[model samples]
Target: MSDFQSPLEAFLYWEANSPNQVFLKQPVNGKMETYTFAEAGNESRKIAKALQAFNLPERSHIALLSKNCAHWMMADIAIMMAGYVSIPIYPTLNQDSIQQILEHSDSKAIIIGKLDNYATQKSGVKDIHKICVGMYNENDGELWEDIIKSTQPLETITLPSQDQLHTIIYTSGTTGTPKGVMHTVGNFIRSASIMKQVMGLPHGSRFFSYLPLAHVAERMGIATHGFVIGAEFSFPESLDSFASDLENCQPHIFFAVPRIWTKFQEKILEKMPKKKLSFLLTVPVLNILIKKKLKQKLGLKEAKFIVSGAAPLSINLIYWYKKIGIEILQGYGMTEDCIISHFNLPNDNKIGTVGKKLSTVETKLSADGEILIKNNCLMTGYYKSPEITASVFTEAGYLKTGDIGEYDHDGYLTITGRVKDQFKTDKGKYISPSPIELNLSKNNNIEQICIVGTGIPQPIALITLSELGKAKAKDLLIQSLSASVKEVNSQLQKHEKIEKVIIMKEEWNVDNGLTTPTLKVKRNSIEKIHQPLYKSWFKMEDKVIFE
Candidate 1:
């Protein structure tokens, strides 16, 4: 393998060396559409030529709104080859967010691909050129297929310099409006190189790209890393076919957030009741058989590396997966750092921590306990927001991560909570809600939860029960949750103890604006929605307040 300076060079190298090797397998219209290295390279070049024909200025931003697809990757590569910065928008975002990102990034054109609802998304934009990737009936843009067939491929590919802007990824805002994080080609190369060295994935390793590619973590971990290591990438047809897709791909490396891991646990327990599965595992011979069979059934028997990130995972969930012969290593990083900060490695793994800092990264705790980092892969800054960008870094030049964390003796870092998420009570004592939430989430009955106590005497929990929990009698569900709440409260300080656990009447989700696209709880949004009930819930005599 030859050393490459940029991502385009890497793609070209694979295209020349392994022309016929399958690079992407995308399920389209109930059929698999495969793209070889040469095909993807050729298509991207054509797209680049079409983009150049538009005569946009150098380094103009091109926006892409789509779910995970092969066309999404092709568009991104084309944007880079045409000397333009790619700005990806989450497909699930509402019209307001879509309009905000488009205007903020100063995007000249947008490529619309697979989305849940395009009519609403398209109506929000006022002025911008639109290009349709697939079959869309709207009269807004030219079809990608038409451009590829008519336009000639670029005679020469303009590879970007290390310092040149590559993409502007908007953060998935859990608290407020999203910021456009600027990343250069050098940042991605450094991060991917470090990841390649750390994981040591063999050539032709299978990668299933189910997560939104717009997110930096998915882009770096699956798309960029796959290209760097010459891995085969596969995309699911749709959410309905996710299971079959996973089974078909049987990926060598798998990455998912905590919510997905929890869902997996629920699915397994649904098939085989926890008590029965526990009993079978107690027998020596049955234990081995059951573990192997279960992993195979879940299509993770071939996975060499399993990672969970985006949000804090419960320690008990990790232990539960370990019992089934799958060890999930939790990683911690943000968009500003190219999502390559800390990760747990095999064998040297710490159960509850996000693991030690990566070899290429430097980290230290701030005076106020915030995690500060200085690394080669850090983003250039927030696009067009120099003041805001400057505020995020410390005087010592380290990125002042809003998250508060601590390191153990061996240098394993445990995320205690987020500084922004901490709240004060009427008693004037501050509380971090994440640790308490993690403890309560260990209860199999709890699906999702948020702890809030701002301006109140004692903290309160708003919880959404799991399917199993909801199937049981209401009294039984409350009893189980009460026991779990008491157990968690026993470990907390007096001011931090939860006063009540209120069962939420409606499910919180992305469509409902209660959760982010990545499934992180939108604490501010949830609080606002339930603000009216706070006083009434506080006055309730029962410890578990069920609606």
Candidate 2:
């Protein structure tokens, strides 16, 4: 396995060793459809032959548009085993965004999953081959099954160099357009292996993957290491079914973004109040009892790790989970770096810090405090945009993370803010909105909150309340939310405190341009659209409580 030339090669070797092991599962028609490594490998071979039948040059680009389904993994390895590059798009993308990515990547063919919104996408884009999941609508392009059946299994194909591009992950540009970040196989495999070493991802590690696989986080968190290590991966049929799915999988290893972690905390605390539960744990004997109760509630009694990343996590939430015997660690990474840069090690947990640089990567902080990352995990460059790529790296060799980070005496790294998200209050105090926002939104009822007021006396919290919690927590909502925000406000300087709160009635979604498909807020745009009204809304009161 160590001698394998690339990640895909290692995966192929694992498949040969344990062909009958259950490698992947997908929900079809609300029922689980399973696949063994051998079955999946054979299906991928069919797909490779199908791709080769196009008569295109070797390593032709193929795009995968789907949610976290077993087929998405199948299509990816198929592309790799066939010596083609895979460009994946989130299944939630709008038709226009999908077209832009497919067109931008010059994908020769697009494999799509069954999504209601994308039913019309087959004929919408130009110059790209289209195939649908499950069945053929005559108006839609060819059925996915039909294409695989048309070709015999590929016998031989030369794999690309380790440094060759494997995927182009497109991310939102600060300017509202998107840029494709290109990564090579070495970058991906090495990053994935770092997680394996940091966490105890020995063979047969159990993992449940529900995040949008198009994100680099999932690409490395599940698809990359999960593939090479032959982990048991279970997919949630849909977001609504995620809890049921998690209960069923009860994976030993858990990795989730801050938003999802927040949701998990929210869901748990909704049934059991965190503060009351914490008070009950004041006694040593009761603490263990409460911890057991919490574990049973989370269905994670056996889960060894619950790591949070893809954004800043609130320290209060981390400490709260710790009180219940759950170790919630933070990770720091970006698409440009193939998703892993820093991880809070198990024995080395610091509440506010993201963690130390992975053993496989080296990091340095510039005099100005910008993080400089250099690793095999660093991407080749932004696809077709050398100017931007060149700007992100040092001529001497380091990827400028654009994150303002600092290291404690213990070597753990804490991210203060994005260099881009730093804002100055009218009082001239510089404030980073992310940490404050994370602290304030610990209330399970507030789904998302963006801190605005770059040029004002203090920040204002524009909150998108969690509709899921509305019906159940109706009477207790306001007091609960105010208490949570106040607790977070205690940690902030007087100038950095939120002067007011605005609870939004509507959800800020990707389709609305408020959030990226990955759920990170488009802060600049949100501020631009809402900042002007701050004086009228915030200055009039200290707290705008929704009655």
Candidate 3:
């Protein structure tokens, strides 16, 4: 059972028990600003009183647009305490998307906090009540400091029930337009209860929050989890200062997506070449010293538990990290599932699979091999899209996760590919690109890759080379890529083999609509952009085609 029914109740309990304990830390300019439980609770009550002064109808929808910061949590708590639904907008979204989410959710007011570029987001937005968290121009909105100072704290706290609507999070939209996924307070409480058990962190555990707070994984894993366990949440000032911030905090529990993990590996290899490190590890005494030093340098020596999610992690990457004494556990979940479906626990972990389902969640495979889940943590539905919501579930009420998967004898789940990502060739042969892509990505030279061959005889790889790969001579790079491709092809059937490799000059990113915020490749977008080049590349005689 959960200790508290709602997040606000959790905050209040912590405040009453440990009013002087620091709960949050955020960097401002260059110095760190700390917030105690008492301070945060008082500030939230003040903001709630200021919001109630508007006298809007009950259960008003309030939108928050900001990067990860201490004030962002304050705004979220205030929204819930005021009996309002919180809609979090990704700070990286363009003006058109920001406007569309605001209009779709029917938000009555907006709370603006720290952002990279506020003008771009506020460009087309007007006629809405804006409450700014920090410094802003007069035309932007009302100042947060001023409003909180003028208003009194709420005399009576409005406690929310478990079934009440809590948050409506909009999907990052890797395939198409974004949709709002509605989750209730009960969903959060139950998910947090299970996580509190799984993590087993003490009251003063430290967490570093760097990912987008709008994303479900960060929201539940960091924000909700911190609130429940009374953990200290730390936010970095900027990307340039991330290394220093991470080392200074030395988080007890760390979570990162696979892209970040790959980057960390590249950084380490730059300091000590892979060949030398491998040779050193073979020596008896030097191996322990080298691993300890490497972990300390990367600020992971103090991390008790590390997790990687949001995309498929290559087993090679997991093994590489393990050599440095950091065992990364991979997990699987989506926005609609409240981000607590499956996890690879310590001491019982499998390298390739996404681990077993949580004790609270029930899972089964559909007739077509799609993974289906039913759990207390599942979202209520997509907001305002009844048809789209109904189509995502079975008549028996299991959520159809769209990804094809298989289970091991021990009930561990291995995701094979997406149902929509599979394609057929002119010869009537179907291919699943994920397993093939994973094998090809074992090459350190390849940073990002996608396998595309919808209408051709055999599949071809579209790759964005890493910095080291790009710096090498053209002939040398081609030689390395060709050897890796041949090794991967040797394990595959004749029809499933990749005929050629195309080296792409352009990079894929969230800003360019090629990847989601969580770093998952937008396969549909990639195919649409590169499909026309397939025939031309296939006709080339060379096995490695440079574009």
The weakest ten consecutive residues by lDDT in model 3 span: 133-142
Candidate number of the best TM-score: 1
Q: Evaluate candidate 1 by giving its C-alpha RMSD to the native, one decimal.
A: 1.3
Model 2 lDDT, full chain set: 0.78
> Ten-residue segment with the worst summed lDDT in candidate 1?
133-142
lDDT of 1 by residue, 239-263 (tens): 8889888978889999999989988
lDDT string, candidate 3, 293-401, tens digits: 8777677778877999887888999999898788999889888999878899888799999999998888999998999998887889999999999999999889999
Better of 2 and 3 by lDDT: 3
- lDDT by residue (1-547, candidate 2, tens digit) is 5645567886787788989989887765578889898888888888777777677776778998877878888888888987888888877777788888888888898777646466555444567666666631233466768766775777785666888888899875444678888888877777777767677667777788877888888888778878767787888887677787787787887787667767777677677676787688898889888788777666577788777887787777788778779898888888888867887777877888988887767889998899999877788888888898899999768999888989988899988778888888788888888788877766767788888776678888888777555665655666677677788788888988877778776678777778887778888778878777877775575475441
lDDT (Cα, 0-100) at 360 in candidate 2: 69
Query: For each candidate, what TM-score against the reference?
Result: 0.98, 0.91, 0.97
Superposed by TM-score, candidate 2 places the C-alpha of residue 199 at a distance from the truth, in angstroms, of: 2.4
Q: Using lDDT, give the best candidate's number.
A: 1
Whole-model lDDT values for every prediction: 0.88, 0.78, 0.88
Candidate 3 deviant stretches above 4 angstroms: 135-139
